[model samples]
Target chain A: MKLEKGVLLTCDPAVKQILLMLNNRQPFILQDLDEFHVVIKAELEAWVRSQLETELEKNTYNLE
Target chain B: MAMQKGASSSTSVKTAQHSLLPFLQTQSQQSLTRLYQRPSSCLSIFRLLDPLSRQLILNLLWLESPVPLSVMTAWVTTEGTRAFDDAVSILTKLHILPNPSVKLSLSPTFKASMRQAIIGGGTTASFGVPADAENKKPPSPANLDAYALERWETILHYMVSSGRGQRPREPSRGVIKLLTDSGLMSGSEAAPQITSAGFQFLLQTPHEQLWQLLLRYLVMAEERGIDLIEVLSFLFMLSTMEFGWDYSTSSLSPTQEVLMEDLRDYGLVWQRKAKSKRFSPTRLATTLTSSLPSLPTSSSSSTNTAAVASGTGATSEGFIILETNYRVYAYTNNPLQTAVLHLFVNMKSRFPNLVIGMITRDSVRRALANGITADQIISYLAAYAHPQMRKFNPLIPVTVQDQIRLWELERERVKSDSGYLYQDFQSLGDYTTLVDYARQMGILLWESPAKRCFFIREDGHNVMKQFIERRKVSGGG
Candidate 1:
């Protein structure tokens, strides 16, 4: 599904997981990406990488 | 899942809160980052936001550079500072605004997606397509509206009537399961009993009722291994679909086809035959994005149905007139309306086209016990306030509203919170700074100056921990 522009469309399972959570009524924080086993398209891969990186930073900050 | 169900006594009161905007706000950052990938979802969310939030989003949308919090606050009127801050905080919570204090700008994905929806030139077909050009007959708006109202109320009637020892047309098995799964009802499908959530569901506005059910449907669909993105896009696409027009189901994906069938049962769509290739979107489907919760002509469908079934011309504007003496004069004979009113009203008399009831302290408290809040009852009344009563400065008397709230508040004499209690401090200076930080973040639930102790919400721990970390790093630097 074309959830965002500038990202190549792929039938990635991770996208499906994201879609499920997006529709979820209750709040959830993204904790693990390993749970979503899907290939990320090259262009979108960079965005995913950055997202994980930012989350990592935030988690580390809290730990500190 | 238990949290949403609010099975716990302490959380039962707070957990019942559900709305599209708050739902979006609680989404995971990853999910939101992906959700904003679609222009339609962006626009849908933007439409759902409050007016102040909309203004804030638009202001940030067109910015060439990130604006500081001070600059943004300066743009708002002095009286609107709180609203401005609330809007920014909501945006921030949704990750739509990365940072409010440092800078304000729409998230990259939302910015692009919203821009696309407004300009409207995308092959994504996100707005929906008129798939059937060869339809022999298109459904009329009035027919579609009536069908929608009838089917929707069938579900409502099923819930209310079953509880009140009356037999109404049985709702579909899927609809029954939805109510049961959402914790709105319990018991076997044929004899489902209304739960506290069911009472709250009955009191919600039509639009909210629709969204809550639809959201539950999404979860159910996901469990069935249906693609949620396809279902969600189709749902959003329905919101944009033209009312009373036939759309071909031929082009729909397998998942969408499944959704279309479910929509038909809910009366959001009409199919002449079970295998019909074309479906006409009903008013319920078309008005999904509408901000107005009440339909002008059809909001009183309960009364209309009652009039038709009884062969009487009970003309009324779907208004509930409340007097200062706690007497309620409702201008309809709809059993469903009467059943819902019976939840919180002590009926004294009933007429062919009218029901008179008194809103007593016991009744209000009973409704509260049923998990229906006073605000919900007041809003329900305000939403259906008689046109003649609308001329009044306040639709319901202020004294009556206050009394209802006061009665409900009596139960809140003992409050409960699940949070972390902080007491030990190395020094008074350390306690002072941490307390100040917690208060500023609006996470401080309680504090005592003498003990140098404070209580904060559980979620506040991460921020507090990070704040201490930041102080250490800065001081060391």
Candidate 2:
């Protein structure tokens, strides 16, 4: 067994897929756990979150 | 602290207000024992205890010896065991009661001092000695009330006006220092800016706000090389003092004399002049430990019509009306209230008794940027919701509440938890066993059976490692 310290991010599988795509551009995930979870670099968790938010914001409908 | 949990559980609507109980719980046992050395501190701490704890203490106060655990347990009904346990736990934490096994009793110092406080024959004069009746022109209670309201309002108005980017009359240097040191305000001493915590402080009842400031003042006092016991005993003594009664300053210890200066800044006590030999405990000081409203309620004191006309009368009552369309109508001419509302509402118009505003996306975003949470805004609105609006179950309109929350949620898209990720298990059985063990230990954060991986909290890594090593050895055997 192997153990490593990092931030655990759990989300929808679709969100995980997007995160994987983003990881290709700039590595933030330390290890991919499964379809819905990944171990992210603790320091980059904020950056990864903001990246995901920006990505999700594009597809969302804005009334204003 | 346990008492607060018990109180919150029973009355879910009443948010836990700031009190000296939580502050005292954080003190060292030696400090707490020293605090209980005074009769006034004993009485004051007793008053602050939850009802169940007070009952238990009273039952054991005069006992010559410890009571049997079973006998004390029998006094509480089965339905009250939870509250009883909570009360006992708080008492033990405060060191008011000795640890329980087969018997329970109040601590020796606390019991003796508490007895003296009740029986009243101590030469120590833990209660203040009244000044001689030589000063024939002592301020009446009504004048003291107005003085306290003005002094307190000045501090509050300073905080509110700072948020509006305007400069009002600044409070004393000590008050400003306490405000900044407490994280209620940020920025320089010359131009302190109000923080989100300051905004929440504005919404709290005057009693809670005073306690919050005093707790911070205690911390400030400790850093200044002043005796904590002296400050705490003075505060408790002030609580027990009668409003309008002048206490001689000559009897105060040197540390308490310094504390008197700071307390005067907060309007807790009124002194005719800095060199006065005696000072009167204002309404704020007397109401410190009691359940009485710190500020004069509109219904209680009609004699303070000047206070009412000055807009201080709205301190305790609800005066806000929030509608479904997000329009906010506040029937308060109080500038302090208006400035607090201005924090999160886009003001449109103001009349004699009403202010109109709107809770818009930009307005809420502004508040959010200032570090104010959605729940704080919603609760502040709900707390001061107009009587008509309070008829609803949730107080504030559900739509407005949900919208404010959604705006806050937009900023918090991801939650992060640091832990150890366990992967590359040798077998499904090993993975399942380890996962079950982690779950049993209540340290499991996330897991995936298919991937043969799981996450355990950072603090549990050592325990999990020991478990794995033991399992390996046993399986090898």
Candidate 3:
């Protein structure tokens, strides 16, 4: 029997931005993860994390 | 609740009413949800059920206790045993019965209210008394037919065009607002786009669509403090009303007058003046419950509305040819119908009086995205297929229909349903009885006849309990 796997995504906006990554085929930050979905590629993730590394930013991440 | 089945009553009636009344009565108090039937869909399935079965259920629902199947069986005499068995089976499947300990009773509220509806002598006068009009001249049915079709087509055209052409005078602003609010089409929306549901509505056989829209109107009227029984009975009465005769409006209650104005929008009736003493019910009104195939072509109601009625709503049976390739060709140009086809088909071309479309993956997905269901699309296609389509060996190539379903199934890869699983029966004999009873009631989802095991829907909880109790009493082990 072949059982199909599914990921039911409920909430999280970061996945939306990373969806654009499908435009590229390689050097893809999120493509190789094999996860059903990804929040952002490492490059994109690193860029956003470093840019908003303040306590307020951390609090905002928790809020999100 | 089960009332005592009188000798005069048939057992089928007794058993059905005994089970159904309690169920309906129980749900009625909770804002009258029609049990599992959706708030929007019609109860035609229930309508199709044997009327004797319904009456029996209604009659006994007022009783304080459940009607024993034993007693009900006796009431039907020898001839009705099979029907009694079938009715009980259906009721149990619907999950209306309480545990099957062989006997018990209805939910208290269901018994009381259902009895009230069936008995019918309430001062509330829920059934509308036709208002007496002063103008006594009865017009010929021909004149009435023409006026009705004209009035109905004019309004449908308004919705179809959405003010693109000359805006015609209609019944009232309230009627327009009700159409928009029901999501049939937002009449007030600038460039009203036909919602997928609206498209489905357009493809409905003429009679069903009328009931759907009219029911929406009736619900709205009920919310505004108007009596439902009066309006509902009046609507039912309209089915019996003579098509071409003018009746007096003078005797109408305030609520009936309100409905009159609204009915004009749907072309149920026509009035020369706002408070015209004489009004005639159009073909739309008289044929409220008429069968689909009979209505459009029955020259009786095909007067002025023939153009819109003719162009799209053919009075004659249709011509549709379904190819082995899964393409469907329909002989129609009705905007409403074309919009419906667009829901499940990728239209390849259109000729003067014919439209051709292919049922494809992307087209179906787009339809699903818009909230139109796979079942609705299939039924719509089947309902209006050209007469020729019906003559196909299977009425539609099985491959295409199966493909339509497969295409839909691929979209929803995961599905979930809540149900009850029965395990660990004390003995095979005990278990088999309950399983057979459950299956007979139509609630069993899966069963192992060999293993004495089965699964059923949640609604069967009531019947399951009863079955177990009966076994305990009967010494099934």
Candidate 4:
């Protein structure tokens, strides 16, 4: 979970894969994320929130 | 990875060279000499050598003079002396070591290059350069894994689904041409079909399959006038990069830039766009130099990525069940695995999560016709056999193994080898000398002492020819 000063923290390919699948707008159940280790769960949750914010910002800017 | 049971069984016939090591070992001296110029290539080659060979190479690397044979033999335990000799022969054959009879010494070029790799003081930038901080988020490892799987599976699907009357998404033209050139597929793109070599390819381990394609790409690159040396050095370098991080493409040569495009197409890297300044190595690229067992446990099954990505604990490593009666119950939802299984199995039924198949004499013989050997199929089965079955001494049922070999041997009774026949020497001494030389070189296939003639493999013809020419020059003088 340690992120270097400027470097982005990279997740396991499996974790990145789950986040990328979110782009398809498919709803994943809790059991799905549970399959990953507890450490990656936090990272993935953070990534999902950030993805949500990016999507929300894009919509707001488009409307403006 | 499970040890190949058939490989250990002396009864099985010899399998064709399905690995990169044999191909590397057979390279001409000029190619090896040119290849040794790059430190990364030397390091990669060094890694592939036997452990004894590596230790021997290290001992000789800094030595100013050659270590005599007697001194070299004393370094290893008595039991390892034979393996030591084998290591020396392999090194000499690959031109890594010189003058085995008199003394062992590293090739000057290899010593210097390998030293440079170890000490890490060089401007070659043979290892890729890390990019500066980027604002955009790097693609997640899972996504890259998925992308690689999707892209690679698409190619396999194109090959496997050719005659099924269903077109899975086809791979690009470049990949198709690659397959065609590699002799995996034949005929026009409009109706491409898998050749027997393709079937044999389908049965190889995932790592071996990846290298086969990459090796073909290297050849394709050379054909387009790209410097093969630079391309190879870059490939060896890619195997060493950290996964999931961006590397700057600015420092790459023009040849690497083009090579990068093709690698991207093959799903080894991810770039935001064709002209992106930074690219990330996917799991495929990172696992290049890793041993078979060391590849990500989850990435073993490409088709299961979606399931695994969704946090399902399923892995692709072992899902096959082979019964004593030759019935195969493969627990696979991936079409690619199913297609590969269908190649040799008389697939009786297909379910959502399982495929029921039986290995029959006809089916195996048909596979044999397609260039897939009995040994390859048995090894493939043993490699993917169920976890329960893996605990057994022989992974597959012993009876089934013997039956498959029996089926293959029935057809193999009349075998063919295309090689050069050397005979009709002017003297017995001359014939004996050439035969002895061929044996030393390990290229003599068969010989008849009565007729003073022998056969050497086609590729070994060049070595034999060169030896005779050198002998003629020396004898004339």
Candidate 5:
């Protein structure tokens, strides 16, 4: 019955693991919902998205 | 891709005409009835309705008594019922059909005015009155078309040049005011910058763009204490007006006179002098309600000096060649067209009659950052693809389209929603019941049954709380 206001982010399980690692450094995650979902601070959604994008970019093979 | 393009382009045209419908629906019922009093407005609105609605109106136009709803319903085929219902609903919303009860009848004012419009007998002169023929020297249709094209293009060119740091001629003060008011541009009038909406506006066909501007003008008119009904009727009258024929200004009300000055700035009407007793509705104004192109096709009328002088001869026809390698070659020297291309293409060179560019990932991303969507850019290229490109089943090379979409998708990786996470439910039964309840309410965002937790939308939290409280009272928790 407890209530909290935050942004729920859904992504692949692999991406969730990356989010967990980033959380340890910056502490934006409010709660880890499951393997594929996490709740982050509402105000930090944009910042977290940018961080995840940059982190994922390193693992992707780019042609250009 | 071809099917998608066809579907989207058709809907865009529908939206261009129906855009006024949404505005009209927002007005008070009284105001709508007042608007329908004018035969011109009634006819214009009839033209705006979908085919089925138009049919329904025509069928009911001559009937003296209201027909039973069942009779009308019986006339529609099984597949047409949805469209029938939609037509009825639109009519009811616009107050053209006052009620949706057992009896179906057109609103009295609407019926009378519409009949007057179609049957051609009304003293109100809802259609514009013809000016006296004495000393008649009306502007030729070609000249009117050129004038409309020039005035309309000035507004567009201003918007395009705003973002590029180039200073094109600023449009009239009223035009600038309308642009800023409509959120197409931002900042002070002297240094207005085109916004994302402005970029999208540039991509619309001139017909849609004019409606967008006119709708905004309607709002501005209301703010200025001008009668909405008068303004609307005047616009509808203009749509029914014949191009190249002068309409007498003697019939205009004071409010309409003011509007005439504003409409002139947009090239909707042309007068010989500021104080001229007669004004001619240009091609732009006459085609306001029809799906026809507002401006003349530059290809068919290459002799249009203003269009040729401004190099807008390529405006309507296919002039772009997009390669699989993402190289773009546009066969136009119009600065406005080139400015629009600069929005999503990296320009390499510009010749008198051609411009070459490439749709690089960076360029597309920059457009995306400015809130110009991938679809808008793709459609613009597709719409203006070279005649040779049109021979292909799907224009604009599928690879180029897919890559542009992927670039857009790359920027939208994460999906986020603001909601409350419910955890620590008393038991599995409690979690299941709450989850089912949230699902029924259509507010469930995400749920994890194994963890005895679920997420519900922010607005549903209070309702869920009340449900749980009621359940506890009944000893279910």
Candidate 6:
């Protein structure tokens, strides 16, 4: 944890927060969920589940 | 053994007298001695400093290369010089600053914590992770709020349900045991009664109330070697989360999910069932991100002036109103909150929206007897003193205030503290300079001007020796 006697590099607060998030983040990342793109995809999964549930319910109502 | 008892003329002055700055991390309170005693989570250095101070430190934390203090002060502006200087001095005193050249930087440990805390990745895992769940419907905010308030109140109900007290319905036995274990109450008298600590805990802001409980939990968690940082980080992340947004729990660590469930009991989060993976953060969880109060009442108390334009800016709005006549009125519907106030007030009546009471010596003394300190009582009142009361500096009325202190003082006639004692200086000049320096750094404790001795709440061995060396180098004046 030693530092050079002088000179500190500054990080932007926005970037700093992102870094803090990543730093505290679990070291191991899910291969499929590591990227921001993957997170978006997972979010898409929720929507798909919602839609699928609706379709299945409609079909069940018809069958009844 | 070190006491300089006999002196020709000893003018003993409490000049350097320092009690542990109620604020943690004031060196006196930060020792390796207390480290193992408490869990690592309490060691989150940032908790001891308010957000404002933490921000000021983080801004200066990363000068990858050293920057002069002058350069740093320019960023916050001269108006913030006091804050900047205070922050630097604090960092230095905490030994977070290795050297105070013209410029200052955070200690290595602080830099690491700040970077991780800011960047959100530390080995510590201070932030909470969402829990994995089976497919289930999401819990409603109202239900979550009710759940949290009920569990917390059940804890409080246990506190107030001593044999002498009325039992409000029946709080769960588990809740009663949690209260007893937390030392907020005990089962000494057939039924538990509120301990002094319990009464004081009841009076704190929701944030502090949460902290007291969490700290107690931390102590208990210490036995099991629970990671305090991980627990804290999870709580922090929960506060920043959107109230209604669902987080995927599949990515959460087992420990994190375990914590999420515990938090669920407190209403900090909501899950459809034990098998549900995702949880929704309630107002309480969202407010955890900042120490500032986030009044959960914007759902209804929208007309409050503080919340109108600010939009939850008065997140810490205290609902206390103390009239000059020592009459206290708190506008709150939370029964637990009412019971907390009743601890130190002689309740006159309860209106639909407000509880009227007066602060008397007996009331204050009764609270003190329960193990609450006067400072805890006062600060709780100050922190939640009504918005109108808050407009005035230091808030609460002076006459009513002095009486509370007097009552506590009568309980313990002398101030009690633990710190290093220093004695027998060669000359008054040597002692005077040391005293002044310690005072400047805000660590000086007690001094006898005539006796040539001064004490600091912290040991000055390293600093004092450094001061002597610096004096020799400069040619002692």
Candidate 4, residues B6-52, lDDT tens digits: the string is: 55562332222225666666777787888887787888877766667
Q: Which sections of candidate 2 miss by over 4 Å?
A: A1-6, A12-35, A52-64, B1-18, B22-38, B60-70, B92-124, B132-136, B157-165, B186-199, B297-316, B391-394, B406-410, B420-441, B455-477
Candidate 1 runs further than 4 Å off: A1-64, B1-18, B25-34, B52-112, B294-317, B324-326, B359-369, B373-378, B391-394, B397-477
Candidate 2, residue B127: the lDDT equals: 86
In the range B59-92, model 5's lDDT, one tens digit per residue, is 9989999999999988989998887888899889
Prediction RMSDs, each to the true structure:
18.9, 4.6, 15.4, 23.9, 3.1, 26.1
Name the runs in model 4 displaced over 4 angstroms: A1-64, B1-34, B64-66, B76-82, B98-103, B163-165, B293-307, B310-314, B409-477
Q: What is the TM-score of chain A alone in each candidate?
A: 0.36, 0.90, 0.23, 0.34, 0.90, 0.31
**Comparison by TM-score, 1 against 2, better one:** 2
Error of 2 at B466 (Å): 5.3
Top-TM-score structure, candidate number: 5
Best prediction by DockQ: 5
Off by over 4 Å in 5: A1-4, A53-64, B1-17, B28-30, B133-136, B297-306, B309-316, B424-430, B471-477
Docking class of 6: incorrect
DockQ by candidate, in order? 0.01, 0.64, 0.03, 0.01, 0.70, 0.01
**TM-score, model 3 to reference:** 0.54
> Can you write out model 6's per-residue Cα lDDT over B348-450, one digit (the tens) per residue?
8898778899887667777877777766666667667777886785366666666777777655421223244455677777777878887887766555676
Worst 10 residues of 2 chain B by lDDT: B1-10
lDDT of each: 0.71, 0.84, 0.54, 0.73, 0.86, 0.56
Candidate 4, DockQ to 2 decimals?
0.01
Provide the DockQ value for model 2: 0.64
| CAPRI docking class of candidate 2 | medium
